[model samples]
Target: MITASRVFLIVMGLGFIVLGLNGLLNPLGHLAPYGLDYQAPGWMGEIRANYGGMHIGIGVLTALGAVHYAWRRNALALQLVFLGGLAVGRTLSVFLDGMPPTFALVFIAIEWVGAGLALWFLRSSN
Candidate 1:
């Protein structure tokens, strides 16, 4: 008996898991969208830790939420925080650092929309 909320949580969780795997396995390809490059080992470690480890950790958290009914709210909150944070940073970069590539712009839009949806579901569930 999967409700819409559970489905949403699963989707968000899987999305993060995929992103994390990409970051860990193909660090350069993951950063290619942003035209970011790193030549040093320390930077590679940072990328794997931050982008790879963090996203996977977050993904597991949301996936847990999908599994446990009581965790749904927390999962939604995670989504709100994660996606919202990304949207905010990207939006500020647009204003402060100048226009980013279309790839970033698209992500910004998705993040905002995803954050908004998370919030909506959170409120509706309460």
Candidate 2:
């Protein structure tokens, strides 16, 4: 039977995969809510390659952690790093640029929650 932590990791992995695909396939639409509007093709390409690829990589690692005991710790570490970094960046933005949209706030919450889950699991295991 799968534990709650494993289920959380799997769900988080799937979430990242879906978001990554959306960013890769539709950069403009994916970034619209973030107030990012790039007119140049190069900018759009960069967004698709960088943001989308990053998320996809993280998703794959996270999913691997769910199935591979050897990879669980490392996968959780990666998740913590990625989500924590995002949460930090968002917090910085809120301080420097003022509050963002509701959707952005929602993402911040998700990031923090993901980071917290990863941290909790890591600590409990140790």
Candidate 3:
């Protein structure tokens, strides 16, 4: 039986895999969103492309990695830190962009809770 922690990790990992693939496959549209900023550096477009691909690639790899790190109980520290970082980024985005209440709340819900769950699992595993 999957423990509660394992369940959370699996769900979050799957979500990351899906979102990352979507971004990776649709580079210009979904992945390269930051490249469109006027304030972006001259090399930002290239950076954006590379970073987006890398992020997506990492996400995909992590999704697979989570099976061991998260689900099967290995590398919990690294996974915790990664998830914490993601949550922080997402939290910061809400403030910087100032999204609508519902949307912002939804993002907040995902970030804080999802990341919290992952972190909790990591901590408990130790």
Candidate 4:
């Protein structure tokens, strides 16, 4: 039987993979909703390499954790770090730069939830 934690990891991993691929393949479209326009030279490549690569790396790690019991804890830890960092960064942006778009707020919530879930599973497994 698949545990809830494993299920969560798998779902999150796949979601990240899709998001990363989309960003990499279509930087303009992917960023359009976020109010970012890649009109300058090399901006698209920068987004594809940095943002997409980060998400892909995280997604692969998360997926590995779901399939490999030995890597599960470490994977959760990585996720906690990533999601928690994002949440913290977003909070700082909100304070320093003022409120962002609604989508950004939604992402902030998701980041917190992801971090919380990772923390919960990590603690429960101990």
Per-model clash counts, in order, read 0, 0, 0, 0
Q: What is candidate 3's TM-score against the reference?
A: 0.60
* Structural similarity to truth (TM-score) of each candidate: 0.95, 0.95, 0.60, 0.94
List model 3 lDDT by residue over 52-114, tens digit each. Answer: 565565455545644664434442344456666766776787789766456446756776666
Runs off by more than 4 Å, candidate 4: none
In candidate 3, which residue pairs get closer than 3 Å at backbone N, Cα or C atoms, i.e. clash? none
Give the clashing residue pairs of candidate 2, or none. none
- Displacement of residue 85 (Cα, Å) in model 3 is 2.1
Q: Residue 68 error for model 1, in Å?
A: 0.8
Looking at model 2, which ten-residue stretch has the lowest summed lDDT? 49-58
Question: Positional deviation of 42 in candidate 1, in angstroms?
Answer: 0.7
lDDT score for residue 3 of model 1 = 84
TM match of model 2 to true structure? 0.95
**Residue-wise C-alpha lDDT for candidate 2, range 1-126, written one tens digit per residue:** 897668878998888888888889889998898788995989988888876877888888899999988888898898899999999999899999999999899989999999999999999988
TM for candidate 1 is: 0.95
User: Candidate 1, which ten residues in sequence have the lowest lDDT sum?
Assistant: 32-41
Candidate 3 ranges beyond 4 A from true positions: 31-52, 69-79, 93-97, 100-105
Candidate 3 — what's its lDDT?
A: 0.56
Q: Model 2: runs farther than 4 Å from truth?
A: none
